[model samples]
Target: MTAEIVRTIPGAQKRTNDPEGMRKKVLDVAEASFQEKGYHGSSLGDLMAAAGVSGGALHHHFPTKKALGLAVIDERVAEAVAKTWIGPVLAAASARDGVRLVFEAAADELEKQGFVRGCPLNNLAHELSLADPDFRAALARIFRAWREAIAEKVRADQQNGGEKGIDPERFAALVIATYSGAMSMAKTAQEATVLRQCLAALPVSGQPAA
Candidate 1:
């Protein structure tokens, strides 16, 4: 329904102020906070206050900060990939259309979210790729799968009788690289316009980059 390519769709407002509910609330709040402030910037006290939960309760959900960070990345990446990149791309008219659709949807999601959270994979890539190799590997797998899916669709289109010039394999890689790079730049500038401009410029049909 909304652009959530990079960020979680802000959950329903913390409804019940009960204890068990509050712990879940803390996790939700911490998730959003981590996305907003990064792992280092999010303080336990701050997260607790936002959650309206006590320190003991917060710790129950996550005993350590690193544990919580990994959970956040794992869950967020799965949800984000399904929503912003994978499903819709697979639903397009063809492989080329699939690639175009994903970019268009990504751009739309970023702008609709006001580009606040930006892309989670891109966010993680910038920080964790060097700081945490395991996290980086996990995220890299997601990107690779995404590119492969797009490439597969493109190959299918070619076999089924589609347009010309574009090498689906190469083009899929470019789309992934371009979109990721564009999102990173847009987030840094706090403007979706830059990424939107790049998306607008991608030809729906083009020769795969040699």
Candidate 2:
């Protein structure tokens, strides 16, 4: 069909030469699929359909399913962790306050959604870590970055005379562990109560004013 004829066809899309736009569109669909159904569970044909891309277009950006999965982890999941956890902690008055606020916000968001899908990173880690070495490394890096961001916040809070006598790195790990477990429990229960309970029992202490 001619270009003009293609444009006039109902329900037909006009192809663009915008590679970056296409890549981002695929990434958005792939990330959501990976988060909802898992990497192993989201098949390529289904992904292509959901992404509104042909096999050639999908492979042009990601040569394999593993490549797509890695991109989702390195790009999409990392961005989410940065926005949801890291940014809030760094901007909060103290590490304790930062973590508390994150928990509260997460609980509220999950309740509103009404279905607990669990943490994207946590969900992917459990499913992919044991299945592939590259996947493990990609996921490990995100977890490390997340842990370090929290640890850095804790260190800053301590220097300001809060979170006294606590090991920043260890405390950071504890915070992640608590959230991971709470999210898992909440996913199973299909509720956010475990998250609220865990948040209430968070160990780190902050300034009274905070």
**lDDT by candidate, in order shown:** 0.73, 0.89
- TM-score of every model versus the real structure: 0.76, 0.88
Which runs of model 1 end up more than 4 angstroms from their true locations? 1-24, 109-115, 163-165, 205-210
Best candidate per lDDT, number? 2
Best by TM-score: 2
Those runs of model 2 whose alpha carbons end farther than 4 Å from true positions after fitting are 1-20, 204-210
For residues 1-210, could you state the per-residue lDDT of candidate 1 as single tens digits?
A: 786575545653444646356645766886788677877789989988887778897787789877777777667665677677777877888765666777766667777778557676777667778887777777777788877888877777777787467787788887778888887788788777776666666666454332
Which window of 10 residues has the lowest lDDT sum in candidate 1? 11-20
Clashing pairs in 2: none
Candidate 1 TM-score over all chains jointly: 0.76
